[model samples]
Target chain A: EAGVAQSPRYKIIEKRQSVAFWCNPISGHATLYWYQQILGQGPKLLIQFQNNGVVDDSQLPKDRFSAERLKGVDSTLKIQPAKLEDSAVYLCASSSRQSSSGNTIYFGEGSWLTVV
Target chain B: QKEVEQDPGPLSVPEGAIVSLNCTYSNSAFQYFMWYRQYSRKGPELLMYTYSSGNKEDGRFTAQVDKSSKYISLFIRDSQPSDSATYLCAMRVQGGSEKLVFGKGMKLTVNP
Candidate 1:
């Protein structure tokens, strides 16, 4: 089975510029998530979607970051006026809500962003 | 204090040696525990997962959870160069939310 798919494996933008990342989760998975991993740190969740609805986004930077999972199969995360601190890897992951082990999430290769 | 705490180690060891990684969590509500391995410039991949408190083993990897102490550990046996990567421990509250709280991953290198 194919795993989660993400695009624009690498990206670089100047400070104050905008950037976006896309993700296509595994087939039939009902939950999708976006996380940010700064260099030398563990992944920090930015948002989570269960189908077309958001499950959680408390940690997201509301002023600069936003995400959407329209139609529930794919997702996009965007950051506007990107800052140097926003440089990190954007990871997309999915899990089957129907499975008993729903906590086992699978991640994509991630989109790397470097804001200069 | 952070919900989860893990030592960020860039530990290096000879091949075939045994390796141990650990994390401590402050939330007693966390019921699901997991370990993820990430290579350079790549996203994290699930390595092991356990529910509640107990021990689970897969191949050369073993995961142990001690709820009373709020500690979790991962042991790799006969470690190989391929095992070199950053390991992260994560956990979440059962029946609450699916959001996972992660630690500051520990980096390991197995030199041949």
Candidate 2:
């Protein structure tokens, strides 16, 4: 019954500094995702993990961003040398296997980051 | 062109009024359509999900998908102040790769 859980609801760092966000998905959920939502914009997927394995990360900026789900239950997204453009909300979401009803992804409160 | 396009509106309307929001997608491969509502500083929550086409109604919210026109719409009736939030339209292809392409989100304010 518990939804996805995230930590450090808010964060602020200077440009070029590093920041990380953690997420613990719903119990028994097998798929996890990390998304970045800039102010006034929709959420943009950064990466996806399917039980410890990456499913997609094509949109992720490898030069500065990285994420991992080691055990498949929890995930962490990191950004190094953060830029002002990187200021956004990091949202973690999870979902069960695809079914006839379709995959319904549930999101956490998100970790807000502001790079000064 | 972007795969999905939605007007970013900070629309304000009186309470109890009917509201309509829409999005257009360029990808014909997208088989699943969804609507998510997000409040300030919060994550997005799923509001509606539809497969393929046609219309699906839930309470005061209705979602319609027109694949031929590559357009999708969400209609809210008797809106309340609580319904004020940013609405996003998302879509994805069926089967492998659960990547969802999202719109720019439309912000709505219902004044009582």
Candidate 3:
């Protein structure tokens, strides 16, 4: 089975510019997530999608960030007027099941964004 | 106080040495614990997962969880250069959306 897939592997943008990243989770996986990992920090949850609906996005910066999982298969995370602090690795992950535990979360290589 | 605390180490060790990594959490509701290893510029992969408290070993890796103290540990036996990467500890409550709360990853380098 194929793992989660993401692109583009790296991105460079200037402050106030807009950027977007795409993710394709493993087939049959119902849970998809987007996380932001600043340098020297662990990945922080930005948003989560269960099927085609939103599950949790309380931590998402709604003023600048937005994400959508269309058709419950692929996802896209976008950031407008990107801040310098938004320069981080954008990770996409998916899980086969939606229990509190047991299922493994598989991640992509991540999209590295550098905002100047 | 943070929900989870991990010593962010650029710890260097020689190959064949025993490596121990750990994390502590403040949330008592977190009943599921997991460890993930990430290579530079890459995303993390699950190394192990433990429910409640106890020890779970997979090959050369061992994970220990202590709910009473809210502490968790990961041990790599006979470390290898391939083991060089960042190790992250994550946990979540049993219900609701069950999103994971992660700690600052600890960087480990196993020398040849």
Reference interface contacts recovered per candidate: 0.73, 0.77, 0.77
TM-score of chain A of 3: 0.95
Model 2 over residues A1-116: C-alpha lDDT tens digits? 99999999999999999999999999999999999999988889999999999999999999999999988799999999899999999999999985345879999999999999
Give candidate 1's error at residue A31 in angstroms: 0.7
C-alpha local distance difference test of each model: 0.94, 0.95, 0.93
Model 3 agreement with the true structure over A32-107: per-residue lDDT tens digits:
9998999999889999999999999999999999999989999999999899999999999998775454777889
Candidate 1 lDDT by residue in tens digits, A1-116 = 99999999999999999999999999999999999999988889999999989988999999999999999899999999899999999999999867776558999999999999
Q: Determine which window of 10 residues in candidate 2 chain A has minimal summed lDDT.
A: A96-105
The TM-score that candidate 2 achieves is 0.98
What TM-score, over all chains together, does every model reach?
Answer: 0.98, 0.98, 0.97
Q: List the residue pairs that clash in candidate 2.
A: none
Model 2: DockQ score: 0.84
- By DockQ, the candidates rank as 2, 1, 3
Instruction: For model 1, name the residue pairs that clash.
Output: none
True-contact fraction in model 1 equals 0.73
The Cα error of candidate 3 at residue B30, in Å, is 0.4
Model 3 global lDDT (CA atoms, 0 to 1): 0.93
Cα distance off (Å), candidate 3, residue A72: 0.9
Q: Write the per-residue lDDT of candidate 2 for residues B63-86, one digit (tens) a residue.
A: 999999999999999999999999
